[model samples]
Target: MTAPNPSTHDQAARLVEAVNEALTPATSYRDASLLPAVGPTPPVPQPGRPPMSQRATDASALMLTAGLATAPPGLIAIGLLVASGYADPLVIGMICAAPAVIAVPVLAVARLLRGAQGIGAEHHHHYNGPVSQHTVHTETKTRGLFAKTINKQ
Candidate 1:
């Protein structure tokens, strides 16, 4: 077997040294002192009021569920009656109009009750200290499944 070339031996030695340098654990400090000091804890957030009252939300949910539960069967019954020539035009018209007839007065009464409860009415605030007021307005635009919110200060 021929002796290994001097240049090839030197190259192998340099490659081994490079690999050892890479594999060796670093000696530099990796303690918390190398990181930023922790600052004071942030203030807890306050809770906001819901868009609708519990009673109203419950009532609306109940109405929606009742409508969903009854509508399909009711429609099928009406269709069968009309097909069998047993349904009168006036009765059919009244049945179709029932939702509007029931909804109008209910909505009006709800609006009046909401007004009595002072919701959406402006209030006068009296501040007794040096006050700094910062107002933020947010607008949301939604199209299909995507929504984007923009904030103006």
Candidate 2:
């Protein structure tokens, strides 16, 4: 091979120097005590909706996990039963419709109860003679596990 070019050798030397400079730390000591103490990061607040409680979040996670874990096994069992001619059409239909049948009445009752809360007798106030009245109305709204109260005077 021919002799290496002087310019190429100089470029390689400059590149090696740059890499070495980049690898070297600005500070001499790598000890942890030399670094500034950092506190735990604060949680970022979400806008719009309020935060869910740990218990509610845990319950939801558990339900989701249980559903995921059980679905495949349940489906496999049903498939085996159907293939073996052990499950009849009527029994299969009932099994398919079971959740809807159980849910309908429960949902209806919940709706009825919720609707009943909005139905109430009107309040009538009558003042006789000269009277000054000051009224303060406080409204409390509960969503999930958190309650927010608003006072209006």
Q: List the residue pairs that clash in candidate 2.
A: none
The best candidate in terms of TM-score? 2
The models' CA-based lDDT, in order, is: 0.85, 0.85
Runs off by more than 4 Å, candidate 1: 1-67, 117-153
Pairs clashing in candidate 1? Answer: none
Off by over 4 Å in 2: 1-50, 117-153
Residue by residue across 75-122, what tens digits does model 1's lDDT show? 899999999999997899998899899999999999998778554578
What is candidate 1's CA lDDT for residue 112?
92
lDDT for position 109 in model 2 = 97
lDDT of 2 by residue, 1-153 (tens): 899999999999999999999999887755666654776877788895468998988888899999899989988988898999988978988988999999999999999988886646997779889988787666556577666655655
